[model samples]
Target: MSQDERPALEDLLGAKHRWYHVVDLAPGVTTPGWIDLRPHVGGPQLPASLQGQRALDVGTFDGFWAFELERRGAEVIGIDVDQIPPPDTPQSRWAEVQAELDGAVPGTGFELLRRWFGSSAERRSVNVYELTPEAVGGPVDLVFIGAMLLHLRDPVRALEQARAVLRPGGRLVLFEPIDRKLSKRSEPLARLMIGSTIWTWWYANRACLTDWVKAAGFTDVEDLGTRDVVDSTGNKQRHLTLHARA
Candidate 1:
């Protein structure tokens, strides 16, 4: 691993795998991720340190949050499915979407970055709805889910599953897209956009998201506010981060 023998990031970028999170593998060798989350590593959304804790990262695409948890001294387990789940569209459209996603090789970027970082975090091929205490080897001290609810057909059930594997009094961190204008209202409201896309389902306000967390049995919920994150396509999105106790 000498300077002269180091792998070129350009050469690595030529692979077929797509990166979703910007990660620094080596000096000046960062992956060109769709979303750059490096700035939010130590932000209020995540703890500065997770020493002596066990953490679970749901929908850990590309292992960004999982590796970050490991970096903060937590034993992390990242879970994702081998294939992308179809959107809640019509049955006729399901086949089309499934056919397109069939060619997608999930966890490739995650494995690549894991090797680069020499990460001890484990990646499990498990769907979010299938999460349980036994599935993850007992309760974890922290659970982190980011930008995944909008894509799910049953977000509340997914949150309940996340709560199932979290230890009592453990921490739960949720970060997801929020409708800025809709979030201004006092009442919880979520806009349904079922047929708008093949993956996206809801455009919920912050209050609606909070209600979902509460319904999942989490307590002491705290709104850490919103942040604008830019994607690789240069599209900026507003995301709300919430912290709760399981």
Candidate 2:
């Protein structure tokens, strides 16, 4: 199919919002969020404010969730330290998402930017730490934290930043991947293809995350149900889509 004929991530969700996807890491071994993602379907569990609002896709891996959020009717601004594969590989998440049928997230649908994760150190972008309250410059009604949280050594700080980006009533949508002790040294093919290889997270329990949201100073925190993105092989990573207010 031609690129023009392809549907944008938001189109699939039945909306006309702008979409953004960000990924700041190298090729991954396992899908980050280190968990499974359910089929992209909407439900009442979604943030009530998602309709006709703005969203910031942090740590987007090929804009998957970013596009999904756009379809939900939120203007999206995608941000990432790196968009291209690490100097080590020449693949992207956009294409890898399709690899799911092969038990890997194909790279086509997930590819978006062209920078590396650590590159932020030597060179930084003004937009990196830039933010205005959601109510002011279109404060994000919701922020999607796909697999991005795991890679962050200090996820709490990131969460705080996300809170700052949102308005008082805005929500942070998270698909956090708790840490795991995989038996295999690595899933070579999946790593090479989806770039989920070098991923990590704290492997927090539901209760732990609930507490975390509160600790981050969010007034109301609720579970939006966990999602499992299953691959062709039947192996799945477990993840929860959380809804927390600023």
Candidate 3:
């Protein structure tokens, strides 16, 4: 690689930002993210090939999954509410925490990495609730949300909006943290609210997630099972991946 890429890599390295996706931007360079999800994609959680398909990636922190989908021949668009200057809303506080950790504003990392990779995938500064077919320009073939739903105050509404943004028979692949207590008890549609202390709104059990997908007008819903991820603090969390059809 050229010396020019070194500056960009240095900026990423120098920053204190907390990363969720561990992305290999180049042969010898990878982002300093806590969660490395590259191995799990295209196995069961994601499609093996997204050729000729249009995809939307919700809550794309650093364009990891968005770029991955694009690499698979999909025209990809990534949407998130992490503004450059930051907002004053509740979500902005979360962004602030990330900024303090990153030593830069939230959402700025995505722009930097996109330019670094020379990727053609599109990105927008939009909220999850604002996602609709009209807002996204048109319906897409795939909608992906990785480890994002737990942060939303209205996950059901978010899922409904995601469903609206998909073409008929289009797929929605979601990976989210499940409520472990409810999962252990085997309750149907049980949800745990962890509150603002951890910046989490609700933790839906597997049954809760499946029922929400069905209620959102999805024709078929498949539980891809659980995935264990370690956060930046070395905390283990169980996440469930759900595949639903619109």
Residue-level lDDT tens digits of model 3 in 90-141: 6546655555556555666676677777777778887888888877779999
Q: Which stretches of candidate 2 lie over 4 Å from their true place?
A: 1-40, 47-49, 83-138, 179-197, 232-234
Best by lDDT: 1
Tens digits of per-residue lDDT for model 2 on 173-239? 7775432333122331111112444333355655555566777788767777765555455666566
Model 2 lDDT, residue 246, Cα? 89
Please give, for residues 101-165, the per-residue lDDT of candidate 1 as tens digits. 67678887887676666678888887888899888878999999988898787889999999999
TM-scores, all models, native as reference? 0.90, 0.56, 0.84
Higher-TM-score candidate among 2 and 3? Answer: 3
Any idea what lDDT model 3 has?
0.76
Q: Candidate 3: minimum summed lDDT over ten consecutive residues — where?
A: 83-92
Q: How many residue pairs of model 2 clash at the backbone?
A: 50
Error of 1 at 4 (Å): 22
What would the TM-score be for candidate 3 when compared with the true structure?
A: 0.84
